[model samples]
Target: MSLMITDECINCDVCEPECPNGAISQGEEIYVIDPNLCTECVGHFDEPQCQQVCPVDCIPLDPGHEESREQLYAKYERIMAVEE
Candidate 1:
């Protein structure tokens, strides 16, 4: 599943760089996660780097964009392919 930044986010900007997928960005109010790009750090790291760096624990799984691990890996592969 993709991760989401909640209203509880402090806008610390720590999470943005930690996201290997480049899914986190500054939103109008709080940091936002693009579900289409988020991969929960699959194919890059064993765990979500954003969540690890988030001090407030505001990042959570986006239930609305639920996806399996295989799907997340596929997304990662697609992203890597595009970059290449």
Candidate 2:
């Protein structure tokens, strides 16, 4: 599943750089995760780097954008292919 930054986010600016997928960005209010680009670090890391660095724990799996591990991995591959 893709991760989301909730309203509880402190805007500490830590999660943005930690996202290997470049999914996290500064929203009008809080940080937002682009579901299209989010892979939860499936092909890059074992765990979501943004979640690890987030102090407020505001980042959570987005139920609305639920995806299986295989799907995430596929998305990661697609992203990598585009970059290459």
Candidate 3:
């Protein structure tokens, strides 16, 4: 599953740089993770970087956008492809 930042985010800016996929971005009031680019760090790390760096623990699994490990890897590939 992808991760999402809830309203509980403090906007401390801690999670922004940690996201390997660059899926996390500043929102109107909190951080937002683009589902299309989010891979839960499958190709870059063992765990989600945003969740690791969030000070307020606002990052949570996006239950509404769950996907399998293979799906995550595919998403990661797609993201890297665009970057290249």
Candidate 4:
């Protein structure tokens, strides 16, 4: 599943740089995770980097955007292809 930033986010800016997929971005009040870019670190790390670095534990699983491992990998590939 893609991760999402909760309202509990402190906006400390700690998680932005930790995201390998560049999914996290600064929103009006908190950091937001772009689901289209979020791979839950499937192709990049063993765990979600943003979640790992979040200080307030504000990053939560996006139940609305639940995806399987195969879907996550495909998302990663699509994003990486654009970069290349």
Error of 2 at 47 (Å): 0.3
Can you write out model 4's per-residue Cα lDDT over 1-84, one digit (the tens) per residue?
Answer: 899999999989899999888889999988899999999999899999888888789898999999999999999999999999
Evaluate all candidate structures by whole-model CA lDDT and list the values in order. 0.93, 0.94, 0.89, 0.92
Q: Model 3, 11-65: lDDT tens per residue?
A: 9998889888888899888889998888999999998888888778988899999
lDDT string, candidate 1, 26-83, tens digits: 9999999999999999999999999899999988899999999999999999999999
How far is 1's C-alpha from truth in model 4 (Å)? 1.3
Q: Write the per-residue lDDT of candidate 2 for residues 1-84, one digit (tens) a residue.
A: 899999999999999998888999999999999999999999999999999999989998999999999999999999999999
lDDT score for candidate 3 against the true structure:
0.89
The reply for model 3, stretches above 4 Å from the true place, is none
Candidate 2 backbone collisions, by pair = none
C-alpha RMSD by candidate, in order = 0.5, 0.5, 0.7, 0.7
lDDT of 4 at 10: 91
